[model samples]
Target: MVAAAEVVACNEDLITLILLRLPVKSLLRFKCVSKKWLCLISTPNFSSRHRRLASASILLSQIPGLISHLSLNCSSSEKPFSSLDFIDDSAGVKLLQSINGLALGCSFHKLGKPRSYYVCNPSTRQFLTLPPPNAEGHDSFATVLGVYLAFDPSKSPHYQVVCVRNCSLSAAHDRYQIQIYPSETRTWRLCGSPFASPSDIMFETGVLWNGAIHWISPTGATLCFNINQEHLGSMPSPPSDEHWSKRRFRYFGESGGHLHLVEIYGPSTTQFQVFELERDYSRWICKYQIDISPIVDAFPEMVRDYLHPHHHDSLFYAFVLLFVQETEEGSSLLLHIPGKLISYNLRNKSFKEICDSGPKSTKTNTALHIGCFHAHQFIETLASV
Candidate 1:
């Protein structure tokens, strides 16, 4: 048998073919093997093959509720999918941010600095540590969340992660400008001046969707941070409900190409509202409203004191919410077979989910930890196409 190390070290042409044929997880691990391997995997050819193989695996599995969280390189020769658990990542991973297929998680950090977000490919399990953006001597934004990460595979495969900067005393809708971290240059750059945004965000309530980042501003509008232009725009408003509060933007998730929002009703009776972005948002008239509700009766055992509003724009329904008068119980998760992380399609009213993290997985607190990412300039073609 040919030695894998020799195959990687000898020929560039064969390395591409071999690595492409290897399980995605293995390439993730090999990212640490050497700089050369890292460069090779980041290339366009390898990404395309990986996507092709990943698509094939998805088609084979018909389960639609689960999303692919990890795709490992298990064998030298990749083939059909198999029932395998490459890595058992726990919810405690502290997923601070996720964009494209990369997630930025936080672990305990010493030196008294708060834990920070690390760019990682959950499927490949390949991660790169990013230091905190320097805000020294300058006041920090009123609110902050990791937002928008976009990459152009054709152009150096360099990816950019957008961080919302809500400056104090700014009037431009661009008050929330973006700070971008480029993988190739390994540097951070602040985009154009602050776009218009509310002075306050109640709390950081935002999620990445359709190649852009979104947050619920205290001003009661869904604020969208365009990843391509780095501009700030408002999404369609919520359905008219006197009792509704935009502060509840915790469950932001992209599913079936549509952006879904979750709302928690803090009242005598508990209510969970799910909303999808307007299918035709050409004029931003699209809106999300209550889809599912009043679970207090059906899920009496699920006690959740969702008093504190967090970013609630996700599809995760497994976490038990505590009611003042009830006890807590485990909730169920959506299970899709062989899921792959795909972008949300606002026009199609669907977001793609992968085949990892089966329904049996435990509930997660990432709804609050989600950061943001900008859309790749390439995807901008969708607007015209």
Candidate 2:
């Protein structure tokens, strides 16, 4: 109890230990306290250690152009922080993918310039613009399918970008090729030879898990690319219904080191099953049967009024799953409705409104569709590109 100043001066090592445990937002504010404190927190060693122990938050977007962060441990009254002000041109930015703590964003074409990509850390409000992929001649014939990001901070501080293109030469032909850009090299290189793929595969909505980028095909096939090995492989998909040709995938993502897939076979039903991939990549096991009957009962607007027995897809456009959050208490499903965001607990079967839909500018006029809403995990980190 001598004095606060004396205590901090006496135990600089203890102060460093405490700073690493605080959230990044608090650390950012504390930097102005003293010059010595600022120097200690800005070191690469401290940033790496803080990132390794930071808790993850969910970054959700109903439309690709808008993004917001949802803290799992926060109360319902705490509205999710929604803004892209860190970007100079926020209106034209679309977040394509997120891995670990870095977000992969694409800036739409403006003026006479072509589209540009950025790898950013939302926590630190820092970003690095990336050069265009080196797909020279294929630009005219090939359609840019998607750009995916691969990063694992626990293994290395660097990240890689994977650009996929649909190079189908003819109607009968279905071909695809991939180019990878590593941060260390800062140049895009063709990973392997062109490969064949199903025409129905949605490569744009891929997710990174277990050191690989995974794409789930609607035709009951899963495609994967090993970033480290540069090998193309396939994984087992969730059980499919042969009669149901138009199966809708509600979610395909990973949380807490677990990969999950959700499919709603019947459009009018409020019941669905969530499947988790086994660690060894053998099979998908049915982990949870989610019944939103109670939530739907409370909010009747979730079901459309087009009454018809033959029309089995009346409730298909009611809601979209934004995130599947895993925690020590239990897991919860974050969903988006017409104008609200709600969380439904998987274990207790209880539902509550986490927050209202964000600002009007962020809202889109398009009808709800599969893959319309996305939620990616954003772990706080100071790692720069």
Candidate 3:
């Protein structure tokens, strides 16, 4: 009995060491093996260690009903795409944002009907549907601009869902209102508004960084809401030569634990300038200026046949900058051009095409078709809502 007890203790230690190196998805499944394994994986220290070793993946959601997952650490050829079958097909679900391994999704319904919101862990297939926000009378879908999920399961088991809406259209009568629903309380309450007057917050472009949510305003300024402080703040956006009144094509993202903004410019939209926010949140510095001429040069025949004729001056206007994926190997920019998705490496100046089975334009004559697709950085975790 003494020798058997010694062997069991030795096995448990070895098992824990092996499990710590594995991914969260595998650990979640292994939890069902025994009660001991379940308790070990559920510990806070084990969760943090697993998160640190996990690599971020990209979650792509296509209109109507399709969701694909791609790993950022591996090349396009090496990683196989996996579809998310757990999400209900009939819900007409649209992914809003992903944070701390939980994705916030909303299911659309007919007009005047309340939309259903869900917080789900794609890896674990665990989900929680949030109760409807207490909005009286004005229950139309148009009233709500955006719903963002703000939760870090590492800190606490509870999560918060924030809803931004135009109060004028609702019964509130305020220009804009911020409502927060805490999972612990299971109730919705109005929070403080960030903007002084009526201003359109780019909720779709909002990126969570440095314990706060950042969004680009129409007037070339960044509006921030600190998750820890629950306060509003503003920061100056990158200085641009273009007029502030004009719509600027830009995206907010994070790479290597730092916030970055990618601004697309030039006649053909071939020039991509990347700016990284300083750690102090003081100013932005130019990081890389990538030229897509090589990619354009690689496919000369297609460019000349399709692009030159339609866009006489701007031959590369079909290409749109999506987001930047930074890894230990290097950083690459993801671009969408017509039916293809291309990844351009900033370090070696190499371009690789990512196989996408999403929707494409049937018309061969058109240079590009802006279809309905969304992509975001995802980290797999066992965090519950």
- Whole-model Cα lDDT of every candidate shown, in order: 0.44, 0.77, 0.69
Give the TM-scores of the predictions, in the order they appear.
0.54, 0.87, 0.83
Q: Per-residue lDDT tens digits of candidate 2, residues 163-251?
A: 88866667598788898889999988888998998777888888788888898777777789989999999898688677877657878
Model 2 residue 367 distance off true place after TM-score fit, in angstroms: 9.0
Show model 2 residue runs off by greater than 4 Å: 21-35, 62-64, 75-81, 89-91, 109-113, 140-142, 167-172, 307-317, 355-372
Model 1 has how many clashing residue pairs? 65
Candidate 1 residue lDDT tens string, 70-187? 2211223333222112223322234444333444444433454354455656454446766566553344422454444554343434577677655545344435556887776676
Which 10-residue window of candidate 2 scores lowest in summed lDDT?
Answer: 75-84
Ranking by TM-score: 2, 3, 1
Please tell me which model should have the higher lDDT, number 1 or number 2.
2
Of 2 and 3, the candidate ahead on lDDT is 2
